[model samples]
Target: MVMQTDTVLQKMSEDDFMAVFTLGRKLGQGRFGTVFLSVEKSTGREYACKLIEKRKLVTCEDVRDLRREIQIMRHLNANPNVASIRDAYEDSKAVYIVMEFCSGGELFDGIKERGCYTEKEAAKLVRTIVAVVQGFHSLGVMHRDLKPENFLFLHHQEDSPLKIIDFGSSTFFLPGESFRDVVGSPYYVAPEVLQKHYGPEVDIWSAGVILYVLLSGVPPFWAKTEKEIYQEVLHGDLDFSSEPWPVISESAKDLMRRMLDKNPATRIATGEVLSHPWVRINGIAPDKLINS
Candidate 1:
């Protein structure tokens, strides 16, 4: 997928694209796009169509990112954990990206409802996310934004596998390539990202933050404002002396500590994070992965 670069515009030239799908309820909204639950009139199949207006792209980089996201999603759709793009159609004003419709809601909403999870449960969730990260890394793509909201379950089943979504913030990068963009949710951002120099390790850091939030109903660094939260992140002041902290296994905390290290160079890589003892306890490993 990394070696292949397809033209997004080439696949979106169907003149009657809008006539093929009947839009239903809105699923979500973003800076430049609106997702809706739509059905293809020809096949009567359900899909999620993200419609992005060209006029609202803000910058030329936004258009580049849109194309990059389309290419990445199209090429990387072979993995079960990834959300696949079924088709893309463009009109003069906007582009419509039709994707697999995921019925289950965001992983963050689940966390909020549960308030927290046991080590076993949290390990299972983290393993799924790490597996997706590994898959993306193997494709030479880095998900600049890795948060619970970006993870959605396929169904309401208890054992439903999580599907990683929203690649607008993702980009192609070699193993050691450094990215200067300060992208990602503030609460989950790595320290090096704040310093304006980082690589794939930033995703690992975000995974660690998510792990912390999953095991305990609170983030490692939180404050009233985004600026204050970022300051705490840069300071790297982690607290594990509280109630639930005393109950979590040392191995889990150790993994989080390694992932959330201030220096990106020393932080755990996605491969190692997948192999960590905490992540492997859920019966997910290199040989037997959830989404290989």
Candidate 2:
């Protein structure tokens, strides 16, 4: 049945937020939206549906991203590392994006519970992140918002791979386009991005931050506020003495340092990430993946 819209705004989505959206409970909620653990009423298959109020949408900059996200996710659905959007629709008050549901919580919870990755597990995670970044670049799309919270879990038969979720912050930066828009979690942001000159390399920077978090069990730097964090990011601060990280490989540390470099022009090359010292330890290709 087509949705009834007798008195909704043109861009206004479904006000029947409670009456229509189906599946499970509220999983994550942010300033402008909420994601629910939902199921396709017909197929009974599970999905993570993020519901965003159309009127509450912030930033004219967000409009393009909102539309682009739908387009990009459609094109990127087959990639193993990226989450698949099962379906999407707009209602009288909000837009409903039904995406693949990953039962395991964000990496943030995992880190809190497990402390940090064993070198082996951390390597596996980083490889997955690198592979995803490589895939996105190949498609000309950039996930400007990559962080531990956006990282998810999915069982690919044997075990789950770290899946990248929440593309609301992603954007399509055309060739030769140096993005000046300042967005993304303060801790995972690239120095160049914070400095207002970046390209796809910023994704690599965020990926490197994820690697740092997994291996070191904390962000490279910590501060009391967003401004302070950005300042630390601007300066590219890394704490060698941060506890629980002494055993982290020097090569891994080298990779983080290069990935987090203050200069975008001098940052590690895209193809070189998989070959970095951290990714090439013990003469193996760091998980040697040909991820499906």
Query: What TM-score quantifies how close candidate 1 is to the native fold?
Result: 0.89
For model 1, residues 1-292, the per-residue Cα lDDT tens digits are: 1111333364546555679999899999987799999999989999999998766766657668898899999878998999889988877667899999888888866555554445667777888888888888888998989988889888767777788889999999997788888888999998888899988878888989998887676899999999999999998588999767775677777888898888887878877876787677644222221110
| Error at 66, model 1, angstroms | 0.8
Q: Ten-residue segment with the worst summed lDDT in candidate 2? A: 283-292
What are the per-model C-alpha RMSD values against the true structure? Answer: 5.9, 5.4
Cα deviation at 276, candidate 1, in Å, is 2.2
Residue-level lDDT for 48 in candidate 2: 87
Q: The CA-based lDDT of model 2 is what?
A: 0.72
Query: What's each prediction's TM-score?
Result: 0.89, 0.84
After TM-score superposition, the amount by which residue 197's alpha carbon in candidate 2 deviates from its true location, in angstroms, is 1.6
Q: Please give me the total number of clashing residue pairs in predicted model 2.
A: 9
Worst 10 residues of 1 by lDDT: 283-292
- Which digits, one per residue and each the tens of the lDDT, describe model 2 over residues 30-121? 66669889866556677888887767665654555677777889989999878888767776556777788888777656545554335655
Report every candidate's CA lDDT.
Answer: 0.81, 0.72
Q: Pick the lDDT winner.
A: 1
TM-score of structure candidate 2: 0.84
